[model samples]
Target: MNSIFKRTYSYWFLLPAAIIYFIIFILPTIMSFFFSMTRWTLSDWEFIGFENFITFFQEQSLSIGFKNTLIYAVVTCTLKVALGLLLGVLLTSKIRTKSYLRSVIFFPTLVSTIAVGIAFSMMMHPTQGVINTALAAIGIDGPDWLGDTRIALLSVAMVDVWKGLGFATVIYIAGILSIPAEYYEALQIDGGNSWHKFWNIIVPLSRPATNSVIILAFIGGLRSFDLVWAMTKGGPGFTTDLIASIIYKQYQGGFYGLATAGNVILFLVVTALAFPLYTYLNRKEVDL
Candidate 1:
């Protein structure tokens, strides 16, 4: 009886957090699922089955949004992983200004996302922006960064990568630094070059960090909104439309239920993709 009481007392400490999580996350998620199946106003809703989802799929820009989301996720994840790994390796090396450089690289991450977006939006202006002005000085006419349909999505994606690269690098740095020195010493004794050591030891051993960066960046890219919105807002005739932006457009058009359905879809996409990738990465980590 006493042991059971003690366990119960211990669980009581978790009640506050549990209740908060249920209220904030679980309750809202459950309500979203229900609302997605209904035609809703702020005050009332009518049961409409899966009409919202059907309408969302029937949206003309759905295909574009879906494709852009996948592309953005892939490109950002690849860049972040590759660049983060390289930066982590260099920063961890015996460099004189490594500390200062690390701070400089990570500084942008501390800035607000919206602020970054707005600033870059201005900087990327065709004629008046700093980027084009500099290019003009070098006798080149710079294309409009955010105005071009062809590269607008890619432009916004590059900004996202720039903002996120620091975080990925920091993660990789931690992972790289955590590696025991004995491994490197062993490689040295075996007369292994930097390339050999990096491939055989550092790369394989840092799988966990790499996996973390990949999943995070990929998910972030898929659900990207604020940066895209601040820069392009799915502009140039929906050329830069992403899933999140499409959902927001539904809300802006007063299709609350439809937007909710889109949210549910986004949730499912994240869960489905993240779960399998996480599982695969975990297995790889274990194998390593």
Candidate 2:
């Protein structure tokens, strides 16, 4: 009994954290579920069943928001994974000023999201912005980056990648450095080239880190709001309208219950997509 008590007693230390999580996250989520079904104000709420859900779906921006959200998530995740892996490999190699370069790469991530968004918004301006000014100086007519509906979401996705690339790189760097040196040495003895070392060892062993980056980047992309809001506010006519922005629009128009339903839907969409992705990625990791 004493031994069992000692073994289980360590779990008691988690009580405070668990309680906090319940209060902060779990409780609010449960309340949101209820509130989403009601027409409510600060004073009172009347349950109107799933009318909010129906109304939310009936919004003109629903399709646009849904499509843009998926595209944003997929594009950002793919770019972050590819670019981050490449940068990580390069940084982990024997290169001069690697530490300084790493710091420079990560510096953007330390800045405020809104600040980055605002700064980039101006930099990407077609006529007055530095980007086009430099382009014109070199005899190239720059396109309107943010104003062009065709590439507006892509532009934002690129900015999101820039902000997040460092984090992904750092993760991959750690993963690469954690690999045992003997594996490489053995491969060298077997006449393995850099390609063999990379394909056989680095790629397989880096699965854990790659998986973490994918899951985190994907989830962050799905929930992306502030940067998008700060940059374009889903502007250029719903080109970058994400689910979160749609929800905010609803709230702006005094559709509290409907907004709550949108929030619920966003949560559900993220949960549904993220879980399957995580599971599949984990399976890959295990298989590797």
Candidate 3:
């Protein structure tokens, strides 16, 4: 009995969390799968089989939204990894104001995403925005940032990078700081320059942080809705119609079943992309 209790006691500790996870996540998720297959009106649900899924694919905006989702994820993930690594390296180096700068750089991450979107939307206004006004002062006419279909998605992506860069930097900063000082000392003793030390030490050793940032930023880009909706609302003629945004438009139009189907598709797509990428990154980490 004593031995059994010892083993069973640990299970009790997990019970609360397991229950919460089921009630909050698993339950809703299961219901969503069911809801996706029906034409639901709260009181009545008509079985529709795969009609919702088929209709979702038949949406005119589906193609554009899918393309935008991939583009946004790739662009944002790339920027976060590259810029964050550089910022982390700089911040980790010897500098008098490094602490102050770190806080300043990270300040943006603390702001609400929706608020950031609204603020940037105003600043990106073509005629009277602060960005254009500043450009005008320099005798350069700033193009319509949010209104131009060609640059709309790209513009939103840049804002996303700026918003997320700080978190990535902090991750890299922590990773770099974790390295033993002895490694740097050894490199210096061997007459190695800063470049060699960074290339040989920081880059390789920071792989774990890089992996985390890529996975996180990519997932975030794939699921991003609030900022994009708040800013462009998939505007400039469906050019920025990410999967999430398209689903939202369906929800607003009262096509709950179709929207749920879209949600299901997004869940599958994110899982498919993320799992392989995560496995690949982990394998690389193990190899290193």
Q: Candidate 3's C-alpha lDDT?
A: 0.92
TM-score of 1: 0.93
Write down the TM-score of every candidate: 0.93, 0.91, 0.93
In candidate 3, position 3 carries an lDDT of 93
Stretches off by above 4 angstroms in model 3 are: 1-10, 286-288
lDDT of 3 by residue, 1-288 (tens): 999888878778999999999999999888889999999776788989999888777766765887899999999999999999999999998898999989988999999999999999999999999999999999999999999999999999999999999999999999989888888999989999989998999999999999999999999999999889999999988999898998899889888888888888888889999999999999889333
Which one wins by TM-score: 1 or 2? 1
TM-score of 3: 0.93
The TM-score between candidate 2 and the true structure equals: 0.91
lDDT of each: 0.90, 0.91, 0.92
Query: Quick one: how many clashes does candidate 3 have?
Result: 0
How would you order the candidates by lDDT, starting with the best? Answer: 3, 2, 1
What stretches of model 2 exceed 4 Å from their correct place? 1-16, 286-288
lDDT of 2 by residue, 1-288 (tens): 998898888778988999999999999899999999999774789999999887766766765888899999999999999999889889999999899989999998899999999999999998999989999999999989999999999999999999999999999999999888988899989999988988898888999999999999999999999999999999988888899998899789887887888889889989999999999988878433
Best by lDDT: 3
Question: Which pairs in model 3 have colliding backbones?
Answer: none
Q: Which ten residues in a row have the lowest lDDT in candidate 3?
A: 54-63
Clash tally for model 2 = 0
